[model samples]
Target chain A: MSTPVLDVQGLAFAYPDGHQALYGVNLHVHRGERVALLGPNGAGKTTLVLHLNGILDAGAGSVAVSGLPVTKDNLREIRRRVGIVFQDPDDQLFMPTVRDDVAFGPANLGIRGGELEKRVMEALDKVGMADYADRPPHHLSFGQRRRVAVATVLVMEPEILVLDEPSSNLDPASRRELAEILTGLDVTLLMVTHDLPYAFELCPRSVVLSDGVVVADGPTYDVLTDDALMAAHRLELPFGFDPRAIGRR
Target chain B: MGQGHGHKLHFHGHSPVHRAAPHHKLLALLGFTLVVVATPKDWFAAYGLYLLLLAAVVVVSTVPPTYLLKRLVVEVPFVVFALLMPFIATGPRVEVLGVSLSEHGLLAGWALLAKGTLGVLASLTLAATTEPRDLLLGLERLRLPQQLVQIMGFMIRYVDVVGDEMRRMRIARESRGFTARNPKHWPVVARSAGALFIRSYERGERVHLAMVSRGYTGSLRQGSDR
Candidate 1:
């Protein structure tokens, strides 16, 4: 890919309590590529994902999205290029109504009048939530809330989609729908997930993190199906699932 | 989250008062308060007129009298406090109901009761008709502090979240050996409260981060996109 869409080099973070969540993490994501970050809990996958949108600043190095360095001055531009869906849809959808939440991002971008309304409608349509534009977030089912959360981010028209545990609480049918939706999108995808089958089915490439460091980076099938590596790093594939056949989609 | 049991400040339904322009209803409430207070202590005719107006507005709003009366219970403390004004005040004595009471204090108490009830009913009727958001919008439009209204809007939205969280925490504590039987163990409950505060603070930080990522500048938008 000509000039990676996202570039992270030696990024590190330390909480005030002196806990190092990320340590010199370096990764590159190409334009329009769907990649998954697979690791056990506390692997710093979420910390890495937060860096993509400048939610948590990197201490050791830098993160650049769309060739723009992520910084306070350039946050608007960087955020416009990186759409992140949090692990909890409850945290993501906070507005009284779905339409307001979907409109929230576009409004922040200073999009006003009819163009903004059009953007909100188009976004709801993208996630198949047109009928629920006025429904309150709390009234929605978990699956529907997830879709509304997607709409909330999509309205910004971000180039890269970074999701943390998108399939964490979704049913099988919702997962299938999410897979289809992700597959149809031409934008870049960086998903942090512990769901092995989910990661394999949705992502072409995979990266593994363990003990605050990158342990494996390669094709999804190679990284996910390696029994020895899986055991060593606390990763596993579900019974009777073949990663090779997953790519047929 | 289920069955909508806790929302007190919500639009009752479609009604002329509910459909009235937010600005108009806001002005009317202000005017009503002004008129109600301007009336003298013994202008029973005017006081009666004001009460009639309140009833009319309540009926127009379609909010049940029971709902309004139920909420009006919030003023009982104030009413009781007003009821004490005549008894406690040292003034010209009068014999009534076999007990001497202050005549001046009684008139003052009547004024207090009249104004307070009218003021409260005006507010209750307004709240019943207009949603909290529209009321804030009305306040903003009426030149109230934008920062304050924005803060109120956010607080109204998230206060429920905070309550839900507290409820869940209380449930968890009850499940895990928490009890009020021992007054000395109250410190345990206090510690849980502190933990809840920390969790809420952390959640706020996370929410702010999410808002920044989504490009939230300062205000909450409803009508126009920006």
Candidate 2:
């Protein structure tokens, strides 16, 4: 109601080869709210996420973060506000040591010396990866690397934390741990996921994107319970995993 | 992928050499190699002294002699070239052990072996003591171009990722009962290589996007991020 943290209005995008990824789409996420962007493969989920950070310019509409439009001039401030945790941890953690990787974003902002160190450690501490500050990312376990990836973004203190497939390769325990971490965070969250159970547990609100359009936007419980909508959009819950039986957390 | 402590060439140690600043060691390595290269080939005594100096450093560095010796296998091709120098090189002849050999050729061959061995040994000692990251930082401190440093940093970071991807591709190929047993299978291997290149290129683009999303402009700031 009072200036949503992320405002996407009529956002649309198409690849260079004439493949239209997103049609006109409108969504708004308020401060401190967690929202899941749910869609099947090629439903323009990634296209929408890219737009949020100005990685891909909008074909038709505009995306603004916390009232600041994502444009060339506002890119630095916009990037600072919108932190995207990519699906593959390997893609995000590109520095030699965990400390360096975590410090990369802040360092880019000209943060130096003790301030940078403190920020890096604080982020690592939040993810319980404080001990691995000096360790090479390649030496870390897959889940640990994922946690480190989150720290790399968290160090920036973004307003809206955009996670792309956060639970894709995580084991059950890792998934639960990440959920705990994500739930504890105090930032607006936009999770792009096909993990229905995860969405039900983490995000209070869910938006279903089908054919580059928002087909459904409602409470997570309502979205998951709509059998016809789920069937039509190819959104399937795991066998015997009933949302009504377990209910929302 | 499960490399625990240090890089393959690095021996985890806490000796004075390991504690020494990386750029200093880099300069020392350069100085030592230059001195060795500049010495006259006939100066056999000077060569021995250089070896002694290298041996002392190796001892001080606490890297085992056998470790250095084991890695010297990389110089085998050079060693073979040095060994053939006396036979093919034309020079004044001298008989030793009933075999005639060119005197200049023998000296040239000796110099090549001595210089090559000393250089290789010194480099191995440096590598054995210093971590790869430290060495790169040392290069940065030595005023290497920032872009080149960043490229090297990224290469070090993603080499394993690319390697793992290749390994997975190989496994996928093997699972499908494909093997490059002969020249007939070269095309398959070439195609796989092409696929890897394209995948790596796409990954590079994604990594660039990720960097952009995190506020990376044209150049990374020179700070503690190194």
Candidate 3:
């Protein structure tokens, strides 16, 4: 296979208060693959994604994005290649208008003038928010703000898209819309989520992290259907969620 | 696209003032305010001219007079202060409506009222014509400190988020039968305020991380390329 779009080896991290979040975790994603990172609360999933783009420096292992190691020297390039859609849209869409928010990443990369506007427009179009370009993010609904947040990253043209809890606080319609948008994108995806149904719908593969370790990694359907594995990692499917009934269409 | 959350001052219109560049409007308003402030208190004619100028802007911008007047309520405290000056100042006395008042105090109060009202009116006109984002961009173009501009940007962006959080907390407190009807309930309010502060701080950290992940180096790019 071609070089992995993202590769993590022996990654370990702990908070300043000495609470270890990740312990020598290892993961890899190839081009155009959508992988879900599933875990119970405080299970180090967020810590792992933070390390993906050098937001959190690993205590032991190494993380490389698109063949660039996430070090101090390569952060600018790594960030350009690994776009992360944070859990909270409010945290991401800090610009005055949706257009400015979408332009932010490219502007930081020294992209200016009409080219920047074009990039902003293209990203907004991708998320179906092109008409809302001039609207302030706060004026948008939760789902609309979330779409603009994705556009904010898409303008960077990152090789890998990492999303944290993309479905939280979304209405059912918005949730499905987001899933559709994610599936339509042509980039490697690493989604960290507690929404098991979302994982089943969007991701083909799943990796379960519990207590800072990869407890299970396999096809999503297999992982979700494994009652013993789901029970062991404290990942409970919603009541009456039959994995076999939901075909991978 | 829709009514912006918590932004009530800006009146949507397609008038010349609304279409004018934000920096131009901002500078014009600043210059107009300075002129109004510098006008002699006894130059009542000049104050009238200033009022006419603002009125023309109001008409041209198509911002409703009633809407503009309502927003002027923000100047109520200053008006109160100005009103108190006429009663408190010690000066030569004058009789008006069977009440004796200081002549100097009357002039001082007039100056305060006229200048303050003009300034607020001018600002309201600018706000009604321009978007808040454009206003911040105008400040940046005016060469204000970059850090100050960014601080203002973040404040505008998250003020609603924090406000929503506060509202949710209030709902939670209310659901638990907590109400600040007296000093005895102050502790609960104080504790919630403290929690709000901590939550805001944590959100700030998370926002900073999100920025870093998206290649935020230091200064924000002023994207008025259009």
Best by TM-score: 2
How do the predictions measure up, each by TM-score?
0.89, 0.95, 0.93
Candidate 2 DockQ category? Answer: medium
Where is the poorest 10-residue window by lDDT in model 1 chain A? A240-249
Per-residue CA lDDT of model 1 for A145-244, tens digit only, reads 8888888898899988898899988999998898888788778999899888888888889999887788898888889778799999988777788776
Off by over 4 Å in 2: B1-5, B91-105, B221-226
Write candidate 3's Cα lDDT for B180-217 as tens digits: 89999899899999999999999999899989888898
What class would a CAPRI assessor give candidate 1's docking? acceptable
At residue A148, what lDDT does model 2 achieve?
Answer: 95
Q: Output the worst ten-in-a-row residue range by lDDT, candidate 1 chain B.
A: B1-10
Using DockQ as the measure, what is the rank order of every candidate, best first? 3, 2, 1
Candidate 2 lDDT by residue in tens digits, B1-226: 4444456799989999999999999999999999999998888899889999999998998899999999999999988988888788896988889988888888888888999999999999999999878888888899988899888888877887888789999999999999889999999999999999999999999899889888887775333453
Chain A alone, TM-score per model: 0.95, 0.98, 0.98
- Colliding residue pairs in candidate 3: none
TM-score of 1: 0.89
What's the candidate order when arranged by decreasing lDDT?
2, 3, 1
